[model samples]
Target chain A: MKKLIMIFSLGILFLLSACAGENSASGNSSQSTGNKNSEAGTKDGKQVVTFWHSMGGAGQETLNSIVEDFNNSQDKVQVNAEYQGTYDESLTKFNAVAGTDSAPTMIQTFEIGTMSMINSGNIIPIQEFVDKDGYDMSGLEGNITNYYSLDGKFYSMPFNSSTPVMYYNKDAFKKAGLDPEKAPETFEEVEEASKAIVKSNPNMKGFALQAYGWLWEQLLANQGALLLNNDNGRTDTPTKIGWTEKEGKSIFEWVKRMVDDGTFANYGTNGDNMVAGFLAGDVAMFLQSSASARDVIDNAPFEVGIAFLPYPEDQERQGVVIGGASLWMIDGKPKEESKAAWEFMKYLQTPEVQAKWHVGTGYFAVNPAAYEEDVVKEAWAEKPQLQVTVQQLQSTKSSYATQGALMDMLPQGRKIMETALETVYNGGEVDQAYKTAVQQFNDAIEQANKARKK
Target chain B: MSMNPTLETNETYMYQFERVKKSARMKSFIKGMLFLFPSILLFSVFVFYPMFKTIYLSFYLTDAKGSTTVFVGLENYLNMFTNPIFLQSIKNTFLFVFYTVPPTVLISLFLAILANENLRGIGLFRTIYSSTIGISVAAASVFWLYLFNPTMGLLNKFLEAFGGEPVGWLTDPAWALLSVSVTTIWMNIGFTFLILLGGLQSIDRSLYESAEVEGSGYFYKLRRITIPMLSPTLFFVITVSMINSFQTFGQIDILTQGGPANETSLIVYSIYREAFVNYQFGSASAQAVVLFILILVMTVIQFKLGERRVHYQ
Candidate 1:
């Protein structure tokens, strides 16, 4: 018994010491990594700026190359770009590290997270930095900048911007005896073409849209409708949702009719599934983000056609809001780090870098000057479909509706809207679904306002 | 030296005895403490600390930055109880438990009985039945996602072969919860099968032989002997399966993301969404505390019920 006790005690001591060793080892490793950030700039006499972004795949590679170029441009500053999961995840992680010394010098946040970040009080407004340095903002696209600005003050640098567009399978259109060259420009034309496609091919769905709130918001924007009151929450924080008004009801009715007529496949809220459905020939037409053009062209078994987002025939198209992310400098970082991050941000806006980013990743270059670059011009000549997104943005009018809604609870509001879509698709009454969704949105807004007050 | 020899020897002997006893006791006490120290330290750090912190955080409201802002004092719990989504999540969790536990227990027991028999190539069948145990929740869920895809899925194709229309297994709100439950059951069968198989092997063959000698049929023998003898294992499996069903998250996340109007949103998934997605750590901790209490109540009830029926050798 004594021997057993001794053996047991020895085993426990070994385990305890092993755990201690592991804890200390991990602590040392993390400390070493942290030290490297501080030592990197001092070692080479260059200031180091850490950038946390959510771009992946080709976009990440493009960002890395841009950073490399900036680092080589001068020996004064070195920028390190790190890929941090999806937009929401990156924002969440940024929030987790906000007001902490270990926070990254810069973070890339999506357009939807704009309001939250603005209210976070942890960001150094780009307008401030631009004014302080007298940086030229005249070359940036107005439509993209308008969405990120409040009363003409931009908070973040619009890095990669994208708008929603119509993607049609040209092969499917040909098989259905519809015009392959002409894409639907209005909702009525889309429905007519869908009917013809479905009639020709009984096995295929004529159209499918991701049951996402962003698409609904885009539709409302195209119809010149506000998503929320208080000047789409730009001048003042919104206290109520404006989605249950006339335009919102009209868009909802249109979607309901499409679903009822078997012209639209409700692909839930997953964008990838909707894209896959279209690529697999299960659907003839798909409405998705312009950023998806690269993947669609690469994966589709047939020619893919891209066009502007469809609008209601009666209302003039107001264009779609940008859907990608932007870069923001975190406040409270060292002055040199912030300056280095700002320098890298300015370098990213250069025509050469922007054109490379635009051609390599299918996202719209925020800099209008990027279109003048030979690389962008050549790419546009090769694939004219890429020009449609630029034309849409260029033609857009800067209005309250077009500026997009700025609400801290927009993410939760989107979920509520998606729930309403699901309800309506499942044979529920459209009016009731919309009413319930609006009520939920109002409740969420109230809660958000209360929390913000606290 | 001046004392009597007998008195001196007795005194010395008593003193030596007491000294040895005290030292041995002290040594053993220290050894016992040393043996328990690691587990105690780990449990305190990982389990107890988090539990206490959750309870403590439940009374406060956290800001968007995850920093505690104000003490609300049961307001979080009250809000959760009144929220429709939270109530629905509780219902969905119970429904999942109901859909999965009995079927898992019965199917695993059936497989165990089939595999327990001495027959040609029974080992292969046993291995086949237990292979799912090796598959992680994530890998199994991804495979099930393909199976549950509404279009271009193997499940729909199979249905189409039978002249039935394709069903939206994961997308349809009516079928989403059940679809997730099916995945959970499939993932659980392997572990449950192994446990029941152990129970089956441990049941003495003499009982079955005696029953057979008495002209009892297979069903009668199973009911009279095998079931009573395996009650302890059955009890264990049911309790574990119930707890596992309540805590279902991975399959729901991979298969449906608690969607189609939050039909498959189980309690744990709701907690995760509230905390991580919405950054409502206070409300999430409150929900977590409720879930902990619910599971504790359920475990106690199971124990109480099992005490009545679990037979021991």
Candidate 2:
């Protein structure tokens, strides 16, 4: 009798679920909700486009205002902007729709997924789009432009790009008897400093690298680790992984030392926790995306110092990879929608907007033109900390480590490396784990590739 | 009609056969609708339709130029099982279930019995015992993670106050799964407690009195009368708990994230990583199917074992 009732209730529940509306993946679908005026294109033969991005804060507001300006200025094209969730979620959701022909006209993708998006053939090549629309990207930031292009073909419109930097707590450093102004310049120095700082103050920690393998990847790239050996540096073939090189070994050794010493901890394995620990004075230093500086300064209880990542012992840096995402244009959207999206994309690259984004959030302005403009120069003139990110941008070069990795199983690879690090850090063998992980990851890649083949 | 008994008999036999056939058909139809309703509705809405679509899409390659999905079958599943990460995920899931299920079942049953006393302020005790149910898994996991922080968690704080060194609650590979299981047990105890409580309340008082008349003590009475009588509810709770533990995702996602060496990655969490995170929907669906079968087998085993113990009065 009880089991009958159980079956009966479950049946009813299932029936009801069939009628219930689906979850619209709430995060991305409504970030920048605007007035729903028309499902139709623009009036007077104009092209109306829908653009989606996850840029929030002043940058989001600025993008909205620019869109409104574009809508007002051109009767030929009306741009409607929408906000998706963070870059990663947005790309995944976009692909699900894009797997069919129903994709947003334009969507944002992280730098890591750029080659994958290009290889997928679903997104429109920006070079083609620009050629057809006759839009010049000459006014955009020169360095920002460098990261977005592939083989002289601009596949994405770069926006809101930032690099990772060290965020330190001055108060914790002072308590630990370490000079807050002098940042560690190498991995060995960081290790020794961390041990000293940890001893000096119970609450103070010397180092907390946010993404273990992710940081390692960056460090290796800056230390001249080639992410891929072929495919014209992430242009031709996409889906090759190269982590068994000298770079991989060094990174493992460095991380294993930190884990053994207990100076670094990431239970959730997220940068947010590291930031939280730093802000709460549990840790003295953090290496995270430069964009997070403002939020840390605002929420932090002590003076926060920002600095460059420690150079590897080899010392000749290959330059840092650009973190954050870019926007990909879809090929099949209505002309009006594509035009509106293009206009919105161009509007975000303007000097005034870039400068405001740089100042409001710690993400440096990508536009070189923005820095030369009086307004942008003046904004940074009084505030030099904001300039640190841009200054690093000057030293930044386009490399596989700092720029991106072109592997089909990177989303999977991240887990592989994370688990390997955790195991090694917890006193597991690094060499054995790496061999096992690489073989497993390659098998996964072969599987994905085979699925793709089928 | 009485003129010829044979004619009457023949007519009655045909009528009876027709009636019986009609009844059988109607019975089967109603029962079929009842059973089919849940599975069809759920499969169409949640599991089935999505799976059918996902499997259909497993074929074809994706590239920046375009996404072309061809019709492919079995390839995705074959690839998944062959992959070491996926295989390791399987091993880890089983390892977790091994540690979690037995401890949770035994401890929860004990807790239910202890709290079943007819004492003062029993309501307060019940509330305290079952309160964690109200907490969201994600929210509970966050608290659990903080508690397991090796350097400065509540667990370490207490341990240190006793002049003992801190143990890695969720950090060490050996301890990670145990730590996650501990949180799962605490969070879910309230649910099974309420189940056993209802069963305990429903047991007849007359039976106990009869046992007392027979000179049976509390232990003997509990072992003979209560255990046998409560077997049905126990069977149900155990089955549900097993299934729930197998599908465990929240704690792993939030607390350990299937780490300290994938020590806590359950099948469902792996499915999430494959489908949502890696965009390998086809492979993920295959995993979901495999998981569904594993749960079905376990549930069947529980029912088979239950038959011997259950007494339907």
Candidate 3:
């Protein structure tokens, strides 16, 4: 028994030391890796700026090239970009690293996270940096900046801005005997065209819509409708969602009628499925982010056309809200490092870099001057589908509703909206679904407010 | 050198011996601890610490950064219980378990029996039966996602050929949970089959031979000899399958995203959404604690029930 006890205790001690060694070794390795980059930058008295972003695939490649160009443009700073998964995941990680020494100097947060990041009090408003440096802000697009600003002051720099657009199979339209070049500009026209397409091919769905909340939000904005109270959550905290209003009901009822008529297929909440449907010729047309234009063009078997997101016949188009992410400089970092990050941000907004980004990734160039760049003009001349997104942004009406909703619980609100949409699509009563979703949103906002107070 | 050396006293000798024994024991104890230290430390750091932290955080309200700002004892739990979504998630989790466990055990047991035969090419059959075990949850879910696609999926195509309508395998709430459960059942069969096969191989051939000699039919022999002997493996498979079904997330995330009116929203998915999406770490931790307790109670019940019915022989 004594011998057994001795063995057990010895075993425990061995485990303890092993764990300690492992932990320290990991710590050393991470520290060494971090030190290597900063060391290179520090040797030349250059500030090192660490940037965390959520771009992946080709977008990541383009972003890396842009960062490389910025690093080589001058000797004052070195920028290192890191891919940190999806937008939601990146924001979650950013929040987790807040107050920690390991926080990145800069982060790219999705547009929906704007209010949350602002409320966190962990970021330096981009407007402050712009004012301090007296940077040329006139070159940036007014509409893109409108989404990122609060009361005419920008909080973050718009990086990869996108708006929802209609993607259609040109061949499908031709087969249905509809004018291939003429795209539907109103919801009623889209419904009528869908019926013609379905009548042409029984096996094909006339239209498919992704059940994403962003799409619904964009629809509301196009109708000049608010998503939340307090003027789209711009002035103060929103206590209730605006989805119970007439515009919201009309959107739901339109979708339900489409589905009921077998003209529209609901692909659930994944936007990729709708994109896939359009590419595979299973659907005549679909609504998706302009950012997806590259993927669709690369994969679609037929000619694809892009058009503006449809609005109701009676409601004037108020433009769609941006769908992508923006760059926010983290607070509490060294002032020089923050300035270095700001310089990189400025580089990203230059006409040449923005043109490269727009041409490469199919995202809207935040800088309006980028459209005049040779690379951008040539790419648009070759693929005019890219020009449609630019035109949509330029033509959008500047209004509080069009500026987009600002809510700390926007992610949760979007999730609830998607759930309510799914409920309606599944044959549940629209009023019941909207009521339950709104109540949940109100509860979430209340809880968030209470937590913020604490 | 030893000429005038006195003999040691008995008490002194015994005392010296006791000291030497004590020292040796102490050295061995240190050695044992040294051997076990790494495992104990790892478990304490990765498992126990996180568990204790979860319990502690369950009582506090957390902010966007997941920092605890205020403590409201049991408020998180109370709110979770009152939330209809949470209650629905609990029900859905239970439904997933009920839909999965029995079918998994029965089908795998049947497959194991078929594969346990001493025939040529049995290895190939066993390999075929157990191939799904090699596929990770993410990979299997992707495969199922394609198979569940409403328009172009193979499953719907097969159904359409049988004169049935193309059902929305993933879209309709009525069929979403069942669809995900089907995928889970398919994934679990490989593991359960392997366990049951091992159990079947271990059962003595004499028992079955005796039953055969008594002119028992195949069903009779299976029920009387094979089943009773396979009770232990069945118990293990059921317990593991139950636990796995309760924690199902990847498939639900990929295939349905806990959607179609939250029909497939299990407890683990709810906890994830609460923590990551809503940044409600306190409520998420509370949900986690509840899940932990539930799993513990379930495991205890399984063990207690198995103790009575599981035949060691």
Candidate 4:
């Protein structure tokens, strides 16, 4: 009888858990409906805009406060900002609920996700709102507008923007007898500096490049090389990679030379660790997103100097593509809710809010006029490193390569490049790694194109 | 006429007996089904449906939303076999299982034996031995991630203090899998230890007492009596550990993310990357099917070969 009772209880427990699992899955799918009902039933007359973002840490804090300010500034719309993990995770969640009523009022997606977002048919083009409101998008930063716009049409509102910059230890440069004021502007110069730094202090490695695909893209752009065929996939669907062997192999061979000299620090795909290593003085220089400028500048014990992204000596500097996310208005939302979201997005673009955003986070102000704001001027005065990021963006040549590639398969391409970069970092043959990466990248592009047909 | 009537009555009596037996059998079968209904419902909803869906999806191409896009029979499976990264992941997963399973079982068994002693503070030692069961995979992996950090991590600092060069635990392709395996073994020990300790304690004391009376030594009794008695628990632990290691995802995600030239990208992580990250559900489903078959075959072989050795006392 006891054994029978035990089995019976275990069965009950299993049944309950199974039911719970089903309930939760349904709950996720029905979240928007639940939210809508609650908002409608609320006593307040204000419309609710469910805003989803992928900001974390300092960025999240600043974004939340900005939302609160926007809510308090007016009673017509109450924007609820929800953090939805990293860009990859958030995009995955958005994909799951894309066409369903469970989707949020609006979402912030990374730049590489632009093509996929447009193709998903789950987002309303921001151009409709721009035309209706007669919003002057030209007032936004030119480089940012270039990246967010395609054929003079805005599909998404440009929010936070950043570029790749070389962060170096000025103290280490001085100690190595290199001029602290003048930074390395070419790959060959960086290599020479790295060797000097390592020779001066064997304890500190010369350079660290976190095996990140976005950085690879930036490096390619700086060398005037396109990442995809047909004008970086802007003219037509890309069939294969665009960069020449010399353009692609220059970056790899540079890193390989440094590695052979034992001056390269391999942090292998973990940006946090590379930054940590930099702060801990294990490395003298590294390349990373300018969005991390504030964190790196504040944490480093030594004098930090920010410089332009280095290009190959054989190629001219073409500058960097915008490396950040944009605000997308989700489709299928109520007209009132979308209008409220649009209002919040407009509020975010004003010089005051953009200034606050730029000062609070290392991300560039989408509105160029934000630089005139006192807060931004004061912040830039204190940390001139922030000014370099804006300068880099402003100086970026208006080319299709610098405008970045448009493809649904960029995220997959990134992983392929990251793996190839890691292979090179771990002492694999560069030619072999590059060949495999290119093959996989082209295959991914083809597969993505095929998958979209049905 | 009287003889005919008696024969008819006898036939009716036998027919009634047969009908009664059939009705009783039907009633018992209904009762058994009623008892099994809950489990059947759960399994159908969770397991059978997904298994069938995965198999069906393995024959098609899917879009980002996971809806079937094209009917390409066996294309997804063939592509997986041809893909070098997928082949590498398979090799890494099997290597991970080999690296993690035996050591986890053996180390836990050793700890269980030691903690099973009747010392004054044996409870404390047992608690310490089994404490890792409380630490979640994410939290434990994060902890080990810091310990394995090349620059400021405690492990590297210790190595440097010993006058040895720092090693990239997760960065070097040669060491990344070994590093991940070490973390898995550490995380798996607590549960295995507790289970083995329970098995050790529940063994008949009389068997040990009789062995002691026969003037047998510790190793002799452990080999002849204890091992045979504990074989069932050992077998259970081994099987669970093997399955758990094969399905390892959290630690790999947190620690390595299948990095260092895809050396640490095991089967499950690869599936997640394919389905979620790359948004290719068809190929991911095919990989899942392969993994399912692999685990099923291995488990079947283990049960077939291992059950003969287990003494289920």
Candidate 5:
């Protein structure tokens, strides 16, 4: 009788647990209606929108201010802003919510995902709202749309756009008998400086190049090499990899030499060790996204310096490709809600906000007009080091590789490179490694392309 | 036929209900089915459906706009087999499992025995020894990474006091994987320890008393009685350890990131890189399917071995 009672209770508990799992509510209840910033918050029948952004610290504060301003100006809706953990987490949550059709009306997605998000039938085109509203989109700088426009149709709003740059230790350079002011202009010069720095200071490493292929992609495209075949790797069927050619091979060899000689550390073979290494003072120079500047500054105990990205010898360079995330608008949301989102996006793009974002974070202002604006100009004058990215933009032209990478299996291509890089960094034969990696990556790409034919 | 029609109808309804209620095997099967149905449905949607979809997808072409999935039998499999990194990753994973599982299980067993002894303060010692399990893999790995740094690391610092040269734990490819393995064993020892301890405590004390009456020493009694009685727990611990070792990702990712070289590229991490980081979902799914098959084979082998050898009273 006791055993039967125990069994019956266990069964009862299990059923109750299962029901509880479904009934459990999500992260927020209030924002499911609309944002706290909506003008409707001021009057009756107002909608409330919940927005999840990964931007925190000062970025969150700025967004809160924008929300406050919008709330003060409007009388119909309140936009509630919440901080999501990271870009990856936000997208994962977005994907999950999208299935439930309860997704946040606005999200901050990274640039690499913008095209894929559009093609996934997940998002509404921002161009529609712009064309219909006839809001002064003319205020938007040309470069800002470079992230959102796919086949001339805007898929999302641009936020937190960034390009890679070379950040060096000025004091370390001075100690190594290199110029603190006159940074390396060519890749060879950079290599020489790195070698010199390592030789002079045994405790100090030269370069923190995380993924050599990514760095190679940056330099190769800068040197006018088409890194990908078939519409320059843009959301289309890729016939072949242009990196298989001599120019691409040369870039890999140079990196291999740097790795072999121990002049360059690739962190964890195929990982994001460079940023940590640089910040830890393990290396003297770091090649990374401008977006990393905030963390590096906050974390680094050393004197920091910013410089234009180094180029190959005698190769006039186009600008370094932008390598940050963008926000994509999802469909299935009500028209009014999307319009509420649109208002927030437009407000975010304003010069005052963009300038403030640029100052707090080292990311380049997507709004080129932000450069001409008084606040930004004053900030630049006060801190001349901030203009290094803008200088790269003026010099560099966007390449097929630079504009965007297109692949059915884009991520696998990078993994292949990461593996090859790790192999060689850990003492595997170089030529054999890249050859093997290239074949496998291409194979994965081919297999992926075939799989998408449903 | 001679009975009233209502009585006959009542009899049939009772028979159907009794059929469902009796035959414990049938009842249990139906109950199990009902119990597992929700999880099965979820797994089908998230795991199996995607898996079959990938198998379906592996033969087609995809882009930003649309996908054209077609039948390309054996091509994806052939391609993966020919790939060196994939091949290396499989080998690396096996090596990692081999390195981590035995030492981990044995050391944990040793600790469990020590902790199981009826000392004055045994409970305190057990708690202290088992506390490492609570530290998250990321946090523990971060602490270990700094401690294991070749130069200026605490380990090297202690070693240098003995007049030894600093060893690069993570910098050198040869040692990086093992460095990660040591941390894994340390991190995992507590879990296996607890299992073996529970097994030891549950052993019939009378078995040990009988061994003692036979004039057995501590070691002899341990070998003769305790081990035999604890074989079930040992089997469980070994199986769990091996499965957990095969699934090693967080430590490898946080510490070595499958590198210094591809020394630490476990199969699942490689699968993750392909699926999320590289956006090669189809091949990643293929890899996952292969990994699942491998795991299934391992599990089946374990159960078969356990059936043959495991002694339970």
Candidate 6:
């Protein structure tokens, strides 16, 4: 019995020591990455800049190649780009390690995360770097730059920007006796098109809208409607949702009309499934990010038509908000490491790199000069649909609605709207769903403010 | 008074004897504690500390970093009860448990009984029956996700082939929770089956021999002997399966993501969304505390009521 006790104690000691070792090893690595009060540590005489991004698939491949090019361009900095799941997941992780040594030198956060990243108190605004470096901000695209800057101060460097565009099967339009070149431009038009498509082919649905909060916001913006109050939370903090009852309810009612007609396909909160549905000829048209242009065009058996986001007939098209991520420099990093990351960020803004990014993924070139590049010219010549996404952004009327809302609660608010949209798709009364969503959204914003007061 | 000297000496002797016995008992207690020290230390760091922290955080409003900002007292708890989403989540969780547990237990028991029979190639059949236990939750969920896809899923294809309208397996509000529950039940059956089969094999062969010699029919013997003998395992499997159903997360995440208007958002998934996604750690902690109490009460009730029927040979 005594011998058995000794062995058991020894075994436990071994496990405890192993756990301690693992903890210390992780602690050491984080410290080495974010060295404070000391010169930023170098790997092989090159400053290491850890960049956490949330780009997957083709975007990831393009980003990795760009990083490789940046690394090979000079020997002074070795930028390590890490793919950190989705925007939601990576943001959660960043929140957990925001001020800690484990935090990256820089992080790419989604457009909606801009307000939270600024409020996080763990980042250095891009305005400082721009001023210090004398970088020409005017060279970037106006619509893209407008989304990133607040009060003429850039908080983050816009990267991989996109906008919502309507993708439709051109072949289905021809078969339905509708003009193949002209896509639906208004909510009523889309409904009519859906009816025509369904009338042409009973197996195919006329339209599909994935129950997504981003799409809902884009649809509202396309109608020149704001998402949150207080000038879309730009001039002041938002207290409630910005859109009027009519503006908000129009989207629901339009979807309800489609549902009532049995021409709407609902893919609840699953974008991939919606895309698959489109590819399988189950749905003729859908609204999705322009970033999916290359994938959709390449995979579709039919000619895919990319068009501007549809709006209500009464409201003029207000265009779309930049719908991708931006890079923010983390605080508490050494000046040299930040400068190195800044250099890489500038490299990403160059016309050559942006052109590659634009052609490689359906995302817009933050630098408009990239549109002048031969690569972009050749790609557009081959597939004219890609240019429609860029044209929409260029034509956007800059307003508080198109600039998009700023609030940490936007993500939560999105979830509320998504649930509301799902209710409408599932045949719930539009007024009831809209009212419940607005109430819950206001409560979330109020709760957020109350939480922040202390 | 002088004649009581012997009695007084006897009292002092008894006091010394009691003191020695007390010290000896204390030594044994210390030794036992020493033997239990490892597990106690591990549990204190991992389980007990976190549990107490969760309870402590439940009363305070926390910032994005999860640090306490304001003392809200019972506000978080009160808000949860009034929150329709939370209430729906609780109802859905109970519904999911009902949908999954009995089916899992019954089907696994039926499979276990069939696989327990002495027959040729029984090992191969047992392997096939228990194969899913080797598959991880993530892999199994992804497999089911493809099968449940609304557009190009095998299920929809089969329905279309039969000239039936395609059902939105994971898209419709009424069907999403049931679809997730079906995936969970399929994933759970293998582990439950293996455990039940092990229990079936451990039963004394002579008991079955006597039942057969008495000319008791198959169904009769199974009712009188097999079920009574397997009662202990059945009780254990039911309790565990119930708890597992209550805590189901992975399949729901992969399959439904608590979508179609939050129909499949179970308690744990709701708590996750509240804390990690919404960053409402205070309310999440309150929900966690409620879930803890719920699971504790359920387990206590099971122990009290179930143990009476468990025949431990």
lDDT tens readout by residue for model 2, A1-454: 6566346434543333232212224433443242132345455676656566777765577667767876886676766677766665666666656633345677777776776687677777878768987888776666666667766779898887787777777777777778878877677877877887888875555677644555655776777665554532465454455544566677668767877887765443655556766776777777777887667777887888777777658657667777777888887766667767777777777887676667667877767667767665775665455677777767876655555666555666666767776767677787987777667656656655654673
Candidate 1 overall Cα lDDT vs. reference?
A: 0.82
* Model 3 docking grade: acceptable
Tens-digit lDDT track of model 6 for B88-156: 999999999999999999999999999999999999999998999999889999999999998889999
Q: List-wise, what DockQ does each model earn?
A: 0.23, 0.30, 0.29, 0.46, 0.28, 0.40
Interface RMSD to the true structure, each candidate: 8.2, 5.1, 7.9, 5.3, 8.1, 7.5
lDDT of 6 by residue, A247-280 (tens): 9999999999999999999999999999999999
Candidate 1, residues B1-313: lDDT per residue as tens digits? 3989999999999999999999999999999999999988987776667678888988887767867777889888898977888998999999889999999999999999999999999999999998999999899999998887766679988998999977878778888888888889999999999999999999998988888788999899889899999987787778767777777777887888788878888988888777766767788889988887887688778766775777877
Pairwise DockQ winner, candidates 2 and 5: 2
i-RMSD of model 3 (Å, 1 decimal): 7.9
Q: Which sections of candidate 3 miss by over 4 Å?
A: A1-48, A71-78, A334-336, B1-41, B150-152, B156-165, B212-215
Q: Which stretches of model 4 miss by more than 4 angstroms?
A: A1-43, B1-19
Question: Which 10-residue window in model 4 chain B sums to the lowest lDDT?
Answer: B295-304
Could you give candidate 3's per-residue lDDT for residues A1-454 as a string of tens digits? 3234335433443343223223124334434444465445454677888888889876898899999988888998988887777888778767766755567788899998998898889999999998989987877888887888788888998889989999998999999999989999998989999999999998788877777889889999999898888888888788777544678888787878788888987778867666766776778989888887877877888999999999989889989887799999888877888888998998898989999998888898999888889998899878889899989988899887888998878888888889888887877788888778778878988888777773
Chain A TM-score relative to the true structure, per candidate: 0.90, 0.85, 0.89, 0.93, 0.83, 0.92
* lDDT (Cα, tens digit) per residue for candidate 3, span B84-154: 88999999999989999999899999899999988999999999999999998889999999888776688
Q: In order, how many clashes per candidate?
A: 0, 21, 26, 0, 52, 0
lDDT of 4 by residue, A344-371 (tens): 9999999999999988888999998999
Give the Å shift of residue A221 in candidate 5: 1.6
Which 10 consecutive residues of model 2 chain A have the lowest summed lDDT? A15-24
DockQ of 1: 0.23
Q: For candidate 5, lDDT tens digit of each residue in A118-208?
A: 6567778888888898866656545555535667777777777777788888888999999998888777887888898998887678876
**Chain A accuracy of model 2 expressed as TM-score:** 0.85
Candidates in descending lDDT order: 6, 4, 3, 1, 2, 5
In order of the candidates, what TM-score does chain B achieve? Answer: 0.90, 0.85, 0.89, 0.95, 0.84, 0.97
